[model samples]
Target: MKKTISFITENFNKSSPDLVGGFQGFQRAINMEKEDIIQEIVLSGLKGRGGAKYPTGKKLMQSAEHHDKEKYIICNADEGEPGTFKDRELLLHDPYGVFEGMLIAAFAINASHGILYLREEYKYMIDDLKNALNHMRSLNLLGDRILKTELSFDISIFLGAGAYICGEETSLIESMEGKPGRPRIKPPYTLEKGLFSKPTLVNNVATFSTISAIIRNGYEEFIKYGTVESPGTKLISLCGNVNKPGAYEVPFGMTIREIIYDIGEGIRNGNSFKFAQIGGVSGPLVLPKHIDTPFSYEDLNEIGVPMGSGAIIVVDSDNDILDYLDAVQAFFKHESCGKCTPCREGNRQLLNILSRLREGKYSQEDTINIEKIAKTMKYASFCGLGQSAPAALLSAIEHCPQEIFKRRD
Candidate 1:
């Protein structure tokens, strides 16, 4: 049965058409009033695809309302989450969609400049991206007075220094300013003050691409797919112990079972399913029983999990929970920016506890201590890196307490 949908990947197998007659959506957007464009987006029910799930329309409206004339639009292409590579596919195949999305967002927000923060690991795609930008300029799809209109918006690519923390919007801005990529305190949020201390609008690659689609196809066409709460298709990165592991774009309402069995072709080598981690390493480990849960924000949030980065990693029965704990904890420990004491010391403490558990020396006090540190990091950390760092281990404890706290004999 054909289960995967093709919205973003529609042009994956073909070369992008020239923007001379294409980018009708971009043309449509510039012709419409900015407020109407934002209103249509709000009505479309499109939320941020970059894990935060914030309303895209609300974000645009906020930026548009700001009196700042030097607003900026940023496309966050730092695909840093473990096991998540959907953004790369978008930039690779649908580069035009990304560019058009940025242009639309720029026009709507009344911004003059834009930036695509490409990850350092994706240096290989730099030439192609530059070529695309140059091609757009030749067509007058970019640069001053695009399409002979009064709106003059331009986009440029900025390479990141290989910091996972830069995936966060403010931290990304800090890196663009030639500083260490650490998150800033909120209230003067990115929309109010961001890159170069100007009002900035930041969105992920999938998000910008979706914006172009929404405007091109019209919001009514977009609302036809997915659920009311999470209306629209999502590009999910499916990997780990699955038979057909790859990126699959599906609507928001599909159950995890359908994704793993029907879409992913079930567990590899006939092995029984153990659990699956929805989102990235920071997402929770969902047990086999909960596989029936729909892959939507409200559904997953009801179960205390997030649809982070849309990366689902399936696991087989052969793997032990402790192994995952050790691996994920190690990742957080290494990635911790040490900006906040709770995250820095908390990750180290969680790792220490995991080690003792592996050595069969864990006590009830160890479990209590792990919970203490995770809670602290979740609430007190300076940014999301620390807040979500304990998700995997905590979900492991929640779903398989026996395995996590069992004596390793």
Candidate 2:
């Protein structure tokens, strides 16, 4: 297969370098100056790959601007989303990339401590990260004065119990603080009150990992890959009935068709493509009509969908859209912490309506009620999971109403 994206292609030259493979002596601190590092990251136009699309440099600058006697950096590696494994691949293949990124972030923000919070299920990555940490320590990369510079930083690995809600930044902080993973109300955001109620910056593994390339090559070089609004490459985990089902790093503006047909080598076994979920559960269900849509935050949002955690799940003609909706609803229902009544009750009611639809008990009235409940969940819920719970169901119903509304007589 011909590789079209430069992000993966450029990195492929190293192709699992020995330094990334638990070997010591690779310089943890590169020769690049700190100002150059910030400029490079700013030019790269990188955004958080965790789906929010927040500008990476801006985040670092915000933290840097607020540097105080105590500040912390956090790498969110809890890959709990269904069908998303891009972070796992990055951690397994290029653990040092993440470490290097975190170090740069720590330096930029003058943070004294860093932590990589990973899911316990990713045992391999956890072990790999530990090995990488040890390797860095042996070279005097992690402890005390790093690379003989005045900057001192250390990273600790915290294993999460694998709750999906912990993927939320504040919730991850709450989890690391030895509490149940429930998202806190924002406005005194993580940059202000996070991790032990101190100033902190929490970013995804991929977002931090990209820092290596930015610092190494310069921001203009990084900016060469993506569009104006969303610069830099994004790693997408392509799964579900695609010829190529692994993770691949592609430029941000690439079309869905390019990813599906070219990169994925077209649907598996000649099955006709039905639809695809651009993001995870929080993302909207994209139909055939939206195939040409550019894979960027703005583009997806303008079209009523959000480019979430970059999990591209392709569904074929054989798959039932309603069943998929049911599964998604079940996930939200099960994961709801029940702190809020609308989410707790709204999710259960949505599940029941889906069950009624599946059993042919749904009338037009039931469908109307389902829509109403979904709207309520969207506006009334406290956190993101609850607010976005209706994304899949709403998209499925909007795009494939016939499939959902079909009578069983």
Over 342-385, each residue of candidate 1 has an lDDT whose tens digit, in order, gives 99999999999999998888888998998888888889998889
> Compared with the true structure, what per-residue lDDT tens digits does model 2 show for residues 1-409?
5365554324532433344432121233345565556666776777788878788878877777775777888898988888898888878777777777888877767889999888888875666678778877877668888878777888999988878899999888888888888989888999987878789999998887677766655566777877788777888999998988888888878888889999999998899889898777777788888899888777787788877889999999888887888998999999887889889999999999888888876777898999999989999999988999988888777777888887775
Which of the numbered candidates is closest to the native, going by highest TM-score? Answer: 1
Candidate 1 versus the native: TM-score? 0.97
Q: Counting only residues 3 or more apart in sequence or on different chains, how many pairs clash (N, Cα, C under 3 Å) in candidate 2? A: 1
User: Candidate 2, 151: how far from true, in Å?
Assistant: 1.1
Q: In model 1, which residue pairs have backbone atoms overlapping below 3 Å? A: none
Query: If scored against the real structure, what TM-score would every candidate get?
Result: 0.97, 0.93
Candidate 1: stretches off by over 4 Å: 15-21
Largest lDDT belongs to which candidate?
1
Model 1 lowest lDDT segment of ten: 12-21
